[model samples]
Target: MNWDDMRVFLATARAESLTAARGTLRLDPATIARRITRLEEAAGAALFLKSPQGYRLTEAGLRLLAHAEEAETALSRGIGALSGSAEQLGGTIRIGAPDGCATYLLPQVCARIAEAHPDLDLQILALPRIVNLSRREADLAITVSRPKTDRLHGERLSDYKLSLAASRAFLAAHGVPKSVSDLKDMRMIGYIPDMIFDAELDYLSALGVTRVPLASTSVSVQLQMARAGGGLAVVHDFALPTAPELTRVLPGDVALTRTFWLTTHAGPKDARLDRITGLLRDGIRDEIARLEAMPVARNP
Candidate 1:
């Protein structure tokens, strides 16, 4: 099998588009097509289902993804070792995160890392749902809770603060609640109960909120809803600085705290990955501390 075909296959699978893969690989359209065909022939199965939309991986292709990723990792390590840059951080590292951390923190944290390591490629998969590390969805993931399975390894990053918040307009329109019990009577903005992917994310339930008239699975979206004066939301303290339109509501009475856990597959160790992960730990921790330190406004 041609090793170049594997590279083409991986790129195509990631983008799910021939044109998109061509840009990444810096190759012509015809070359990319020929390579995919060759790879499919070698694998003895149709790797992708072609459509006017884009390439969707077949079941065989999905099964082959794990092996392809392993091969890519191995080649990256081999190339680094041969070039005598094994100790230096280089190569792509995809980090999956819940949108709250991803939206407010990762941009700056990843920018600084990417700036420091000019050769590195960093991708952040910010989703409303939990990132599946076992399927290699991301090389690393920042989760609210630690890995529940032994197949993965986790390191605690830091504990961050959260508190109820609403737009100043919202407070003015619907009277600020003097107590936690008063919250139930007001408009509440929070994650959709059924879509709460993690236990740590079900903040509203712990606060005794059973009905969220305004709800979304995305932290960023919920923040926007609260900012628009829709309702009160349990906004991340670190994220408050980014949305100045929103102000804390009963900080002392309705405060919540959560931990960030960095998780990875519990498999072969790579010094390159280890070095970069150390940088990720420091970057995220410092960012959380910096953002959380910024003063948030409160209703008078």
Candidate 2:
């Protein structure tokens, strides 16, 4: 019934671990357990089913979550309205970002934020599983595709170009392809099912093709596989220079490209969110320019 209790449930449901929920909420374990227990008691039903894997929402829990989220949204609006004039950005900012930002962009931005605003807590939760902002799982997000929902306010921050790359050793072993038609003969490492390009089926389709032999999978795994000289992979240019072993194959003419969007809930304009988003936008702008400067081998 209490807002705090519902928040605890929502966090637990998203994290599927009481310990993780506690960390996100910055609360102690006992307090979180007690809150959830009290909420469950009040609801007269079990919200979660605990098993070895993790917390799974019960049917009652799922039903309650729908209503709880609406309540939270209403609560957020009211809080934003009341505190609209607050002068400082002192609260925690929860962000859901892809692995790229987690690896490339976050450290510098986080360090800057820490030095500039010691009072503001930054929580960067890198979920390969994208969090739904509408549910308040995150206050802000950086994603490749902007949400097509009225509930979100977003902007395309930068356009990212990706190229197929391979380690010299792998290329020497498997031999580089001279044309898109040659890809069928080559062993290719690619992102797993949920990856941006993997989901779109556009990365290859743009080449006027479909389906490549899958040698290895997962974004994290594909990077390693390609690095180990296992096979060719499509990766963002920012990832290329950092990965010393990988060499770009198909040039700018054939590379895959997509835009990154900075998005937030369509709530009252938040100064804190705007501040962080602005910094990120500026930082990535420099990165994109640097990427554009790199030498690209144009396909014949």
Candidate 3:
């Protein structure tokens, strides 16, 4: 089979549906079907078994997947090698991250990278839930926990702090809690407990916070509600500078630590991605240090 047919087959195999694969391949479902049929004819095997759910790979398909992925990796390396100088390298790179990092951290980090590589295009997916790298939804993803699967490679990006916080206006009207016990009777803002995607984010539960009167799955939403004097919320320490209206409450009593992990699909190295990752790693760490160093409102 030709490389074109193999490319379509690879995307279809990963997505498991002609319609789903259409999004990434930018081809119509009919075109994808035709290409898959041509590929199967050339190989003289039924690569996929059709079912109600989607396309299920047969044993032969599974075997071909390994070679196909290796070919893709080789193509990536070839492109990286011929991509000329790092200064002139230009292509789109998509990043998936939790809203806190997406909203508060990535803009400046990406802006600097874009400034350096004027031809490069960057897109950030600010998702409340975990980003699915296996789906090829993002070229790179930032996560709270280290990935467990061997199909993905993960690296610790940085460690940042979190703390209970409230707006100055909220404390003025509702008063501050003197003890963690007192928080039981107060209004709180945080993630919807049932919707929390990661255990590392369950900061309020440890504070004996059983109820969140104002809750959301998105960190940016919780920060806005807290800024509007909604209630106490567990907020990123590095994010405090961005929300000066909100003040840290019982910083000593509620300090938390969590690490950000950079993740990518496991494959042969691509120099372009390697360089971009280095810039991102260094940029994020420096930005956090700078933001956390800025003066933030805190209670005595």
The residue pairs found clashing in candidate 1 are: none
Candidate 1's C-alpha runs over 4 A off are 1-88
What would you estimate as the lDDT of candidate 1?
Answer: 0.87
Candidate 2 lDDT over 152-198, as tens digits, reads 88788888777888888887777778877777677776654345432
CA lDDT, candidate 2, residue 288: 67
TM-scores of all candidate predictions against the true structure? 0.76, 0.71, 0.95
Q: Over the stretch 106-169, how does candidate 3's per-residue lDDT look in tens digits?
A: 9999999999889889999999899988777888999999999999999999999888899988
Ranking by TM-score: 3, 1, 2
Q: Give the alpha carbon lDDT tens digit for every residue of 224-277 in model 1.
A: 998888999999999999898999999889888899999987765466776777
Candidate 2 positional error at 47, Å:
12
Question: Candidate 1 clash total?
Answer: 0
**Cα RMSD for predicted model 2:** 4.9
Query: Which residue pairs of candidate 3 clash?
Result: none
